[model samples]
Target: MEEKYFTPEEKKEMLALSRQLLAHTREIQERDDFKRIRHIISDGIKQNHYRRDRYGINPTIHNLNTAMLLCDKISPDRNMIIAILLFNLCKTEFIPTEELVKEWGDDIAKLIRGLLKVSTLYSKQAAVESDNFRKLLLTFAEDIRVIIIMIVDRLALMRTINHHPNEKMVHDVAYESNYLYAPLAHRLGLYAIKSELEDLSLKYTNRKTYTDIAHKLNETKVKRDQYIAEFIKPIREKLDATGLKYEIKGRTKSIYSIWNKLKKQKNDIDHIYDLFAIRIIIDTTTEKEKSDCWLAYSVITDMYQPNPSRMKDWLSIPKSNGYESLHITVYGPGDRWVEVQIRTKRMDLIAEKGLAAHWKYKGIKSEGDLDTWMNNVRDILEAAETGPMELMKNMKMDIYDKEVFVFTPKGDLYKLPLGASLLDFAFHIHSKLGMTCTGGKVNGKNQKLNYKLKSGDTVEILTSTAQAPKLDWLAFVVTSKARNKIRQTVHEMNNRSATLGKELLERRFKNRKIELNESSLMKVIKKLGYKTVTDFYDAIADESLDINNVITEYEGLDKKIPDAAEIRSAEEFQLMTAADDDSTSSDVLVIGDDIKGINYRLSKCCNPIYGDDVFGFISAEGVIKIHRHDCPNATNIREKYPYRLITTRWSGKLGQQFGATLRIVGNDDLGIVTSITSIINKERDTSLRSISIDSNDGIFQGFLVVGVNDTVALNNLIKKLKTVKGVKDVQRSK
Candidate 1:
């Protein structure tokens, strides 16, 4: 035995908790190999210097000790121990994977990879925990040991959380442990480990609730122990009289569990059942274990009035995760209901350690059934899901699904979650069958589409060529397969509608002598207040896009292309509205240095030049607009406008010129503004026309402008600018 692996101080720290593991390992493991592995692990930890720190590795030792404590009176392999000690190492990249592979062989390396894969994915998978968990489980699907190690690894880390300083880490770990890890453990049949996780998680997540329930359990410990003794006395004597070797122990429910009981019972902690159950562990061989479990159950029920409704015989057919026990609730001492679980020692081992014990040691169900389950799970995972959250939701629905096995009329069995209806069943058979499904017959009786299937029912689906799925099927269908098929059908229908709509829109565009691209149509659709391009298309397909209305909208947008007058109107209208104002008249043609300090300028609207008749309008917004006499908004200003109009003109030769941008789009080329600049610069005393070029792939848009005599000169400049080589078009910028 590798007793020397633990020093005296180390023994004092962890010996008591690990004694059971040590004993089990000593019994099952090859002596020299266990000795060498333990020595190597200890030496490796001591010799190597870790260059990283996050969660302390000191707690890792505590976690391993805690894992050993929960791993029950059975051995975990070198992979489990090596992986646990090194799981935190994976996050920091402190150890190279190839080095571990060289030192520890492929199994240990693979196990470590699985653990670290989860550690790396932990943060990224929060939004998709259920699916991520499924992926994680599948990552280690080939090696059952990897999952067992992870469950234990989590157990270790969770036990050491309180020692850490990060409250947020503690809370997050506790939540994931409770909501995801603990349930996973339960599903894996590690009830003992599951209980601990739940209790510890609640301890951190809801300390007050955990504390109150724990305190209450402690207060009634003696009485609870006494009651368990009295309750099990009769069963113990009965088993002994029959000469069946068995060890009976009373089990107290965990705090979180008791809290759940309290909530379920709608009563105080004191009113809840203190001694949750009595476990009868029988000594037997694997061959006779099932019979012995039943015999034990028979003995217990003979002595006490059994609750027929509470009998759960998983012994005949163990859980998918290899959990087997026969439980019965009977009225015990003082008329209190006590639950009793009867199982052979072999079953007890499996129930305690989960699939690890079975897969490594027992080989009870080494292949067929578990493979089928995992294959089904993989199929479910591989199916297409649309939104990000849907993957997790559907994965959770599968992971937490309570399966019910039903038979086809031909005697082949199919598994579906409980509460799955006929529609889901038909879809489960085949998508074509589901799409054409008219109804079904359950066990020789006709059933509706919504009829909930039960176990052992032989379902026969009836299909018709004319039948098709309705949108309302989404309301009743449960499985993702049916939902997916239905959604695909709806999408196909939408595609057909879109095709019709596109054709109709194209015809309308052709009739109007308009070129309508998708981009242009989308712009027009949005301008007409349609929510989506699809909505616009659907309206067209349904004849909702009336020809007159479509023409009106398209023409409105086409007319909005800013010529000089429309540009003037849009600029003035888009500005802040004028308030009440009174101002003195000024000459149309005079320049004075004294007027430079005033808050007024030639408006961008009319751009009144030196020779044009101009008028100044005072604005309460602390600005003034100088407009031409024939400005677009002149009639509105003269007749009905509120702001005071100050008649004025460019009285003198004002050489000052403001800037404007002309947007010129073209294919990428060098010196695109050569001819455009020649025209503007050829004029006498021409102001600088600055150009800024933006190039994307083979396309370029240039913004350039110069001093203009009036709108006519700007117009001529734009026309001549468009005639330049490589220049596709020209437009004025706002």
Candidate 2:
């Protein structure tokens, strides 16, 4: 499909959409500003600068739809609407950023730039299911408005995806809507958009299931309507007697939600209860919201028997996403369990519109709660140690999970996910507390570390210096923060043990008058069948691998030692020779702004390859160490010695190969190892250095060191490995 001039029909639709948008946005934007925005987009459309989207929809028409969606769904401000309308123009450079900024203001310009960055990210085929992609999207979209606009834009795309001819693209967009955009809408409290996106996604991706459920709901519509009417009649009379102003809505759960229930409960649509919910939106003042809701609840419960176990109170403590409502499940007519939600008009608006509505109710404390939650999301994205898919699951939990509000002994309250354990609470409070927590006393009763916490429990953490994070703790902690912290601590401990073990072996080698060859020692370890270098070092650290045994194995191994003149320490390596510089002159890596004759070597810790983003650190030994920007030690070094940091950049690719290690996890299928090694062998100027793999329960984790010239080569190799059968994830070993 290619871009075509807009047909007469398309032009008519665009004009109508433009008018609707202007009408809806009148409250937020001036008439002149809106016209100016429309004129720019219209000019771009005439010039054919705005190409047709994948669905073959006119670009101008699509932008109008997205802009109107933002207006109708979120009631966005003038700048947001302008940004979406002008996104394509700015992207195509028909209107340069400077011109747009001059015409508009800084805020609109920033939004366009962010939108462009996210568009570029999409070009890389970033999967929505990957947490890394989500983090990157959030990073590029520094403004929350950017995220909101993208969600609305996706809603527009999913709405029109059916027109696309590419089945694969349709599937991708549908799954992306379900797994990514829907969760985002949920997190932002866009309940209506979230549910609609979910339903649309389900309809496209699983048409059979969607149709089956839809058909069943349609067949039972009359019966369902009758029951709802019967249930609301008595409550309406009772509410009117109390003189409360309210509108009760009877709505069925979204098709996606019903599908989830059917799969989870292994039941048919006819058997699933609570498919529909009753929302009692009261027109009350903010001060009277709670009292009116409680009064309505008293009236409803008086009419029908309420289930004590199913009551949810969010009025006292609103949800992290700023949702405030009182939920009750009661046995209505025909002994049906029906969920009833009570909330004020303002609260209902916030619940439906999410972050956008928060602007209208800025004085409410829930807005701050939403802001804090977004910050926490950023932290989780940055600090999480799990794989992309696992982090995605954790993010979904954060978005849609029921919150349990627990208090500290000091009366400070913390909101955790439902089923959060005692250890999760400790970690949520402070990482140090989590590290040393022995157990906790919940509501003044002693509880074990694995004890699941309930709402309103005042917890006092019991700690001991002797206690530390364990591998077992990872199995129980429900929060991503707790799980990541445990894994990080355990990894650091193992590294420490490995370091001590290495030092011990080195000392022994020196005592034995044996020159320690790093490469030969690695060969010896592998020959002894150790699957990981860390395991080898751990064995030695615990005295399981005897010094005599290691020494004998090292002596027996075939080895090659470089000449004595070639051996040098970081102190001895003062500069790259003329020959060295000339060989790689085409891709000169400038150290310290091209300080001539100064020496630097890539740090062994992170193994910075050519083309890797790097920084130079002046070590205590007076030698400059080049490290990857994301080096594990980079954070500590930068924080402690800010003065020693120097900017580094690569002007071109280096000719020499660099040592890079990859950590691969996949199923332990037959010949999986051979499949991996074959790919490495097929690459030019790339060779496998060493490999160590461990298998358990049909899954394997392998570390393969390879020699590559640059980060490009390393990335390409990783991509190829990812395509291998049974390979789940392949990542550079930091």
Candidate 3:
């Protein structure tokens, strides 16, 4: 295939635009900061390969253009702005560079860094730690400018998405933008960027659906455009006659947005009406903003019947992202419901830029507000150490939840996530307040912390130094902050309990004169297959592993127990031993004369070490038939001849190898199979007969039939396997 490059005509347009942007930037480059920025951009362009390919021979050309555009948007010094844009592009492309001097010289550069830190890098696979990584990045972004740069990057990418070749890449980027970027944009009040990102992302992630919708819209383009133009003409004329400065524009919904509507509503493309909408931008003083919008709404309603429920009064209380507009669904020509948005130009700008606009226009005067909010999210993550699923769940509910505007007792307004309880409100005040939370009053009425707060509700959290967090608090708390705190407390309690268990074991061992070292008791415990001393102690404490039993076995008690001959005949011994339980013995009747003692030991094939049920039957050669309690053949034989039933009981000392089977089932995860094998190797001196594991449909099922000392050893081994991460269940065969 021939390599594709920009067409000559396209190159000409790019160069022309680049020169214009450069000229605009130079107009404001007289300042010292601008001179430094120009130097950096010039140096950066020369060093960056991608920049050279994208811009002209002079890399400064594109850098200059980006600078000029950004400067025009926010009146930052031209040089400083260019330097920042250059840094952003260079870092994003991974260009090598020496450390930067003059740390705070360019505010724009600082913002770019912040944005880069939070922006998701393109990856072929979904990241396992993507969510936690994002949260960590956000924690480090002290400046809101970072958020602006991120939005700008997304907008730029959308504007130039045609350059990318891979459809999957496009789809991935779109999916990310829609799920992460768009929501972020909405949160930050960048309505324009948010909507555009959503549309662009939707276009790629669902191209087929997007194409179908676009095709339908195009088929009706002429009629739709004519209706929209005619519909807006009367309103425009009326507004013009009133001497109100207003601009009217008709817009087709982004392909993605239309496609989404179709999918969500399960309707055909033709049924989607919000697709063709009109935006009315007005120039008004802040004081007359509401009045102007209301007037426009009246004009629109007079021309078309309005859908009462479809009207959104964002003008009274703007969205959390700082979007302010009056939206109305009006019945237009052909009985089509067309949506209209009325907003001032200032509102439009803020809506487009989001938090960046806020920083630029309003400045970060309230330094504590953003930091406090971020700290709350961090606290929740810390508490969620018990499990990733819990952390993700609580963080989604609390940190990324929709906002509800609430008030303090003194009447200061605060915004919190929806479904926030009084505890969340208390934590929002202070961690101490949350820890000591008792009950609270909402809107001057006494209420529990579990009270579901609504928008515009005044909340006063009651606290006491005597009170502290309880396990029950997790039930009602919605935010990560509260849940994390609760988890932290619980984790501490568990650690303390484990510590106490360890102390108890150490003290007991010391009293017995058993030195706790890497060898001797410790080594033996590890050899027997425990991960850590703490785990051993925990097992002992839980009675899963009896320390006394282990000690008794270790001390060599074989001499104290009677031999197998004293309990049963050689034939009987063979049958009872097959079950691997020393506590049981079986009686067998020899049909032949008693042969002189030919010493016989329990067969190791089925060690029948201890606690196993067994039976014996006479064989053709007068040898005893040994079988396990539930063995198929043994059950049949016992049923056929009721008088042939043999009694068996285990009565053997410890430290004897017995063959046994274990079955494990669990959710498969990395290193889990290895962990199981490791546990078996460590717990007992044993050899696996044949181990097999089959994983399908996210579940892992496996069996390990191995040789071990006794039933206690097998039980201990099973306990150890259960502790391996992601091992859901472990059971021994009867």
Candidate 4:
């Protein structure tokens, strides 16, 4: 792609602004030690040039106009800080320089990148890609200033979206603002940005609905304002009489929120009760803040009868994001349901700015508790998978899921996703604890691993080294940490087997003096059209690799043949079949057929489970073994033993519990396992015999065996397992 340079006029304007910014930057540099800020800004501008070329956008006056508008929305000082942060963040090689380019150049680039990263913190994509979560977590972990920059960036974008014309772009920006930015602003206590983003997103995402509701609200604007003014009169007088300073203001619910209420409650515009809310901001000491708020509420209720059900006491135990207010719905004059929120000015600011406000006023050097919680969120996101749909679903669940506050035996409170299981509790304590968790006790009562934890429940996870993850536990455990630990353990075990298989193949090849170079072997293996070397090794390690076919192709090329039959196959084949079976003449009967005078062994791949359809394969050792037809080795044996095949059926009585393995893959969720177990146990006759589950990057793979009667019952069990929350696919073990 040809490089696109700025037009003379555009360059002149940008250069002029750049020079102006540079001059002002000198003062900030001396005051705040921003020495490297200039270099960062220069680099950002160069990078933006690269992106402009790639995106095929001419650096014309029109584009410059958009950039100028963006600049207008941003403070130069704040943009400078954001620029420094972005330069530091983009030091990694994976992020292309072109993608990091900003139209407003480097000054805005820093802010844009910081904002993008922060936006990603609550994004669906962040949930799927662990690296994204790690990046975001580390960013927040280091300095919350990055988050503030991000919020500011979004606010600026929302303000300047009018410059863009793409409907899809507009809708996306609006949806993002609504679902992610708005809630995040609310969480961070950036009420101004939060409310604006919500209103903007609502305007675009649901224009018709927003317009209808907004029109209705506008129609009643005068009456609503007058009513609110009248309603706050008595409360203001009462507070003045109590000798406390206070200010009263009125707020209407955001249009988007009103539309949601209309849809959820199946109500019209007129039926919305909390449409117009009155705010009572008071000035009080922290120690007496609650008392003063309650006193205000009492005064308001005395003048207007309060609806007991409509009262919310967030002041007692604030939200996870640090929102605090006393919300009450009272029957106002003329039977109107007037919502009132009472809080001190400090509380109001905190409620508006969330964690940001906390940092600003508290002047705490670090994020402290908020950082810890966000780190946990990072863990969840890192363990989740990526993709638009997957991210959207999982991100919504993680960021917006209802939280339950549970206590440890030591009285420390841990906030967990609602419906979290005991396993989640265990993992929340420590990753190792989750891996070794056998069960747990909720409030002094011993319960299964799948036990649903409730708020205020004191949980103690039962763990042991001997108690590794059972496949069945995958059904009951919730929380990404627990799921990720389970997945890592299972992957390690599978990988060990794969490694062993590779070694076994290498040793066998070496015994024949055949040099097995990995590169050469892989070429030959690929020529045979195998998908992966591991698949070939797994086949060989499982004694399923067809050496006869391999050797037949290479016969006479080398002269290591002792006999024609032995030469027809490979030496590896002889070693595999040389085991003695004659010493054990046990006639193991299966499926009403007796293979006399031959040793019989059960295949571990399928476990046969007593009632599964089975077959017998005669080995070179004269051992007749039973295996399910769906076993991984079945296809090889079937192709080799077309004439030797014997149809076998099970005659044994069904057992209450049979050993089998099920592989499941699905979208990850907070309480997936618990939901699965709840479904399984709901039948009462079934038990989760054992389970091993692992999840990372939003993909969940589990191996489970549950108590069942027969194949029919197992299929039914799988059918039921599919209904478990967050489960995508369940397959019977081959």
Report the number of the highest-TM-score candidate: 2
Of 2 and 3, which scores higher on TM-score?
2
TM-score, ranked from best to worst: 2, 4, 1, 3
Candidate whose lDDT is highest: 2
The candidates, ranked best first by lDDT, are: 2, 1, 4, 3
Off by over 4 Å in 2: 1-4, 25-48, 131-135, 235-249, 279-331, 340-734
Flag regions of model 1 displaced more than 4 Å: 1-52, 55-76, 86-91, 128-135, 140-142, 187-189, 232-250, 273-275, 278-332, 339-734
Each prediction's whole-model lDDT (CA): 0.61, 0.74, 0.57, 0.58
| Per-residue error (Å), model 4, residue 10 | 7.5
RMSD (CA, angstroms), candidate 3: 22.4
lDDT of 2 by residue, 139-178 (tens): 5565667787889998998887764678888888889887
Per-residue lDDT of candidate 1, residues 603-711 (tens digit): 4433455566677654322235666787554555566434346655464644444444476788775555455567667755445445545556767765564666455
Tens digit of per-residue lDDT, candidate 3, span 185-244: 554445566777877776666666666777887898998878888887778788887788
Residue-level lDDT of model 4, residues 250-305, one tens digit each, is 88877877877788889887877877778889998999999999888888887888
In terms of TM-score, which candidate is stronger, 3 or 4?
4
- TM-score: model 1 vs. ground truth: 0.41
Worst 10 residues of 1 by lDDT: 568-577
Q: What is the lDDT of residue 523 in candidate 1?
A: 74
Task: Give the Å shift of residue 637 in candidate 3.
Answer: 34
